[model samples]
Target: MRIRSDGLAARSFDAETVVLDLEKSQYLTLNETGSLLYELLRQERTMDELVDAVVAEYNVDRVIAMRDVEAFVGSLREHGLLTGSDVLA
Candidate 1:
């Protein structure tokens, strides 16, 4: 599945990410790793693709990377930060 950052305003610093959901008037703060992941997913990315990138970049185990990426996406979805393929922006 692809995740698109539609309708959200995001800013990334060296160590953190600040995402603003203008529609909901809610925001999220993410650490260095989360910022990188979100930057990667700004376009369309598959689960494996995301995990692979993280593993390669951070030298983490594939299992751990996959789990972490999934959890991050889950939280974004929960907070309405991600726009799923089937959802309208």
Candidate 2:
């Protein structure tokens, strides 16, 4: 899934990312891996694709990467930051 086009603004600072949810008037911060994933989430991506990216970038195991990606996407969804058919509820 991709980031929502409306009511969300983000900036990257080195390995970190900060997101502002205008609709919710809340701020979210992302760590290094999350920042990378956030950039990829600018475009549509599948769960597998996201996991693959985490694995490739961090050299983490597939299972751990999948788990982390799931959690990250969950956080984004909870904050209404993602928009796409592939986005999980």
Candidate 3:
């Protein structure tokens, strides 16, 4: 599936990512890994692509990378960062 990041004003600082949801009036801060993942999510990507991105950027194991990416996506979904339309095949 592909993820979308609409209605967000995001900025990256060093290894951190900050996003402000104009509609929700909420903001989120992400660490190094999260920042990279967030950047990737701006484009359409499969789950594997997300994992591969983390693995390539960091020296983490494949399993750990996948787990972290999944967790991050889950958090993003839970926070309403990605909407139903943002998710597509």
Candidate 4:
């Protein structure tokens, strides 16, 4: 459960989605749920906490939220948007 902030920029659109530009090198388009999850990631929440947050915010099952968050986090890491450490520092 690592989150990196370096070379990553995010913008919310219509309060319905989030557009994340990573390293000015690639982009990730997230829906309402993803946007919410991203916001929580910014706060450096743990994996369990993140899953709980997602479940509370959306009408999805815990299993589904956990899977989705895992996938999303993987993608963010692959894009170098997340560094396995506090990115703000």
Scored by TM-score, the top model is 2
Model 2, total clashes: 0
Off by over 4 Å in 2: 87-89
Which ranking of candidates, highest lDDT first? 2, 1, 3, 4
lDDT of 4 at 29: 80
Candidate 1: Cα lDDT at 21 = 85
Compared to the true structure, candidate 3 yields what TM-score?
A: 0.84
How well is each residue in 11-77 modelled by candidate 4, as lDDT tens digits?
7876555455654666778777777777777766677777788888887899998888788777767
* Most lDDT-accurate candidate: 2
- Model 3 clash pairs are none
In terms of lDDT, model 2 sits at 0.87
Give per-residue lDDT, candidate 4, residue 78: 72
lDDT of 1 by residue, 1-89 (tens): 44444668888777898988888898899997788888877777677777888899999999999889889888877886666542212
Could you give candidate 3's per-residue lDDT for residues 1-89 as a string of tens digits? Answer: 33445677988888898999888899999999888877877776777888888888887899998788878888988888764432313
> How high is the lDDT of residue 19 in model 1?
88
Which scores better on lDDT, 1 or 4? 1
| Candidate 2: pairs in clash | none
Error of 3 at 16 (Å): 0.7
- Name the regions of candidate 4 deviating beyond 4 angstroms: 1-3, 16-24, 85-89
- Give the per-residue lDDT digits (tens) of candidate 2, residues 10-45: 888988999998888999999999898999988888
